[model samples]
Target chain A: MNDASSQDPEQQSMPPLGADHPSVARILRRWRQLSGGRHTRDPDRKTLVACSGGADSVALAIALAQIPSSCVLAHIQHDMRTPEQAEHDRAYVEALAKRLGVDCAFGIAAVSEEPGNLEANAREARYQELARIADEHACPYIATGHHADDQLETLLMHLMRGSGTRGMSGMRPATPLGNKTLLRPLLEIPRNEIETMLRELDIAWCHDQTNDDPAYVRNRIRQDLLPLLRRLDPEIARHASQWSQDLVAMQEVMDERVEATLMEPCTITDSQWRWPRELLQAHPDIMLGYLPGLYCLRVLDNEGADRITRRAIDSWIRSVKSDSNNPTEHRIGPIVAHIRAHEVRFTPAESSELST
Target chain B: MNDASSQDPEQQSMPPLGADHPSVARILRRWRQLSGGRHTRDPDRKTLVACSGGADSVALAIALAQIPSSCVLAHIQHDMRTPEQAEHDRAYVEALAKRLGVDCAFGIAAVSEEPGNLEANAREARYQELARIADEHACPYIATGHHADDQLETLLMHLMRGSGTRGMSGMRPATPLGNKTLLRPLLEIPRNEIETMLRELDIAWCHDQTNDDPAYVRNRIRQDLLPLLRRLDPEIARHASQWSQDLVAMQEVMDERVEATLMEPCTITDSQWRWPRELLQAHPDIMLGYLPGLYCLRVLDNEGADRITRRAIDSWIRSVKSDSNNPTEHRIGPIVAHIRAHEVRFTPAESSELST
Candidate 1:
């Protein structure tokens, strides 16, 4: 066979009646839209479903199975939980794939139990493993189980941490993971809806007991903050999720604009990036505010961008906008800006002087 | 004398020692920066202070009194409280103004005690009264005591309600009110710092017991949510406040761009506002999203814009951008969108179809 997908029979236009749940139809519609018609005509393509045997992922895998595209179930164990729980999850997922008559892949995550970053580390490990599995399966797309409630929680966490529009904009429906594309088909679907779908369809899903553990900040936010918010506004998650999607779209346009208008015109050498003073002054103040972060992200491309503060950006803007003939040097994250009369040059700061 | 402001003697570069609280100095510094050095050379300008007899406003009045520019304390009694409490507040404000050696104006607010809108009505009445007082006193600027905590609280309320960047941008430090300017010099200062300044300066201010009453949503947020956030992040208010300010600045740029790039180029007749189809297509998707809101705010200039939903905007964008362009009519808030091959036109909708 050319590939797993190429060997599969030509699928019918409509879903099979046995697998046609209303939630499945909705998920298929969203997947088609989010993938930009990738599902409509690309019959040879395959998607690796990252199922943790949760309601959300189980539903996603079920929905993708109804559509024409070939799908394989993939389960990853972070080993953060007890061995019994991890093994149980893997077995459940394997059974699910067998029931659906699809191939299955299982992998163990290599997560470092770092203090204060355990959750982040686990996530990184999981995604890394998912990418590796997708590569092995020759699946160009990896679908996940993230839903509207997850979107709302991420937004709340970002808001509490004083993140700007960038953080509050929430996750994208589709983003690249190494060479594979990561897809969240159920991002806009509410968690309760997914659960109801699984119940109505009589599909069993494994629930992680550790999800309620208060030790995790996300769990605390989910249990404490989300319920209180739901009490206040029943549609809080739906509204916040939609708003986050809008912000993501807006930020995409801004990133495009910044890349074309700012990053393109600037001259970059091995040691320094230079931009004409007039070019910097020509843009609107709002666009000017985006420069520092974009510089750190696109130019430096490292962890230094995370430490870049608003105060630093403001001070740098003030210096650039100032009508001073004298040379001035200001440190912004990992880079040091040298401002002169004609142009501004950015160079990597010395290792000893890299703070803020 | 020319005006209350022009009549006042030229002040010194530094504030008098007695009125020189660190918080006051910080407020003045922010005031100068926000005003674009308006306070540096413009010594002949007068500011009307809106004091509610609370610690925050009382401190504001005390700080402004030490400056050279004419300052007047204006207190508006909303009559929301009991007669005894209202009288007590007015009396306390008058006494504080006397202690500060500045002219004081007390006005009884004409507030409509609308069941659910009592707080909003009271606020509206107070601002109206402040504007009237400022106009009579020939004060070009009206200063209020909206500090960082209030900013954080506003952001939280907006986030809970799923507001876009426009709502979560927080309050501006300076905005035009009718013909006068409204200024919040203490916007960046923390609430506790203001209270500390009052205590250190031995300034007595009235206590509003109703602040602790959970009847008000803001009060509830203050009592329950803010404390929880504080326990999590001590600098939450400060960071969120700064982020809000950054959003406000970014929004200002967006507004300016929309006005120039989109609105200015569009054609508006007596009843219809029209834009070339190609012109709409030429702009970035982000700018297209802003077109509907800008049209409502600048073109219609009414409450219809407030009820406009994101879904409506998205559908409208899709309709306008679609290849099949038969004459189409869509209702957007209080406006009707008419899309044709050559141009898209917006006209006020019938009163019968005013609902979003």
Candidate 2:
């Protein structure tokens, strides 16, 4: 542990340890900002850092340890890698944690194959394992090493899937992981900086051998699409990362507008919801564009809201605008929109009779 | 050329000429919707179809001819192509126009190579020629053959450049092309459907030889990135196109909010603009996220507002929050943000002292 603050008064004139590495300082500052300027030595500020023994996570751990808060290194051994490689990863993470003078927790990921979604399943399993580790360690936050490049890759993947603004908004800096707050303090930092910082500190990290497998779509995007995009625009990653931040900001506004204009004015329950058609007509910009998908997510709690199509929303809007006195039903995920002359009502498909 | 509506009453009892191919009718209906249901035979509704002798443009011409309104096929002979190829394109467009019983217009595009931006320069030159031809032909609208695939391509291009929602919104269905309205009636239609309609109608179109040239970034993206994305998700094009539409809708909402909240309350002039600090603090979601770029556009009329960066905006916001009574200035595009105690002022850099 490079404890720069504990230097002797005899060496007070000298620059602090790690002063030459500005990236470490940036990481520390960013983490503090993300945590809302909490006291550095706050007893409640325990974070379990998820480390794959990669340069990104190792650098994160190094910077995070400098904070006076309690820090723990966590590793999830997944089934995708061979036993030898997995052991090597765990060993490297253990040694790195020991060097940082932090306790380490190791867990095996029960990654089960789900037809064509093996990669997604593995990620879910890994996160679940991380949550369990955080629980055992009594940490309120679990931090990851996702950086700007990963943010770009995640955004492209969402774009490829035709996800609208919500998906393109990319990962939030801090979001919920089970009951714990998942913190990604280095999201705005680039991958090169993480690797460069590690090299400067003479810290060795193990490479995750499974990352090159083309079986995962993310690898293909990273290997093929990213390089091609970089060639087209060298600042693409920086631009995209910034765009992601902007989208997040924009999404925050949209969510607030939707909540105030649509959700608040509506009568909502677990199985049924109703909104005034007059309000819908008054704010077509919000009603026709953002309300449908958001209503599904916030009101109905539909997890597959992404599957809602633009055509479906258009059709629903048409129904909402129709002057017919009779009721018309339109499907939107698990719920159905029953539009009448003065109001638009939504009911779960199983409770269609309730609308009648 | 396929005059389905001119059938005799006896033949009208049967199916129409294009009844089997529903796509042509879809195109015509879409055109009428795009034009706000103007009288079909209105002489003022003349449109200059920017035909490149490609399948998409040819299909558009075929559909537009079905409308009773006047139509003229326009072609631009660009320097990027050989004279022989340019002549071939012009000849094909002329023959098609003649076959459709409409007039044709031709113009030469003096496309100058701008260092490494030959492709962009050629496109701009082509559009300028199109606008000129539209003006010469007394056409109020200039229609293009940009379909959903092109929209997806555009969104990806903007994404690579790290453009926010405004860029990712892709091409508008109708926007100002010089003095004329540029209409993309086939924007929602897919490229495959356009080609299929052309093949079904037995219409011949010349392949765009320059399209496959790898020197152009668009060509590389079309060939490499699009195909890779399609493999990941077969409906990626449709999804991105829909996302673009959603983004356009979201942007409309954002624009309206910014106008009503920020622009409406501001004291703006050609060289100076001031916004209340209290209003800004009240709506950080709108003020912090959208006001910077949009203010550059709406207030300063700065065409390069896209160059207004997130960092610049963040810095400006920080200054706006500063408690200092002394004025501080920050550069944003061609204008400078001056932060004062009660308000934030913007002035052209040449006129900075006015902000004091």
C-alpha DockQ of every model = 0.39, 0.51
Model 1 C-alpha lDDT per residue in residues A1-356, reported as the tens digit of each score: 12223444543333343354778878877776766674355444478898988888888988877643468888888766788988898899888877666779988776655665666667778889888888888888889988999898887677667676688678889988888888998998888898998888888889954254334557768877777667666777777777777677667656666777778998988657799988997875557667777767666676588777666777888888887878888878777888999898887777325544
Where is model 2 chain A poorest over a 10-residue stretch in terms of lDDT?
A1-10
* Model 1 segments more than 4 A misplaced: A1-20, A38-45, A113-116, A209-216, A282-286, A350-356, B1-18, B36-44, B113-116, B209-216, B282-286, B351-356
**Residues B1-356 of candidate 1: C-alpha lDDT, one tens digit per residue:** 12223434442333343454677767766655655574344344578989988888877887777654467899887655788988888889888776656789988775655665666666777788899999999888899988888898887677667676578678888998889889999888878888999888887778853343334557767877777767666677787777777677567666666777788888878757889988887776667777777677766775588778766777888888888869788877777888899798887787425543
Minimal lDDT window, size 10, model 1 chain A: A1-10
Q: What's model 2's lDDT at A257?
A: 76
Docking class of 1: acceptable
For model 1, the TM-score of its B chain against the native B chain is: 0.88
lDDT of 2 by residue, B245-343 (tens): 767777777777788888888897765778887777677643555766766766667666756875677778776766667877888766688777788
lDDT of each: 0.75, 0.75
Give the candidate number with the greatest TM-score. Answer: 1
Each candidate: fraction of true contacts kept? Answer: 0.36, 0.58
- Angstrom error of the Cα, residue B8, model 1: value is 7.3
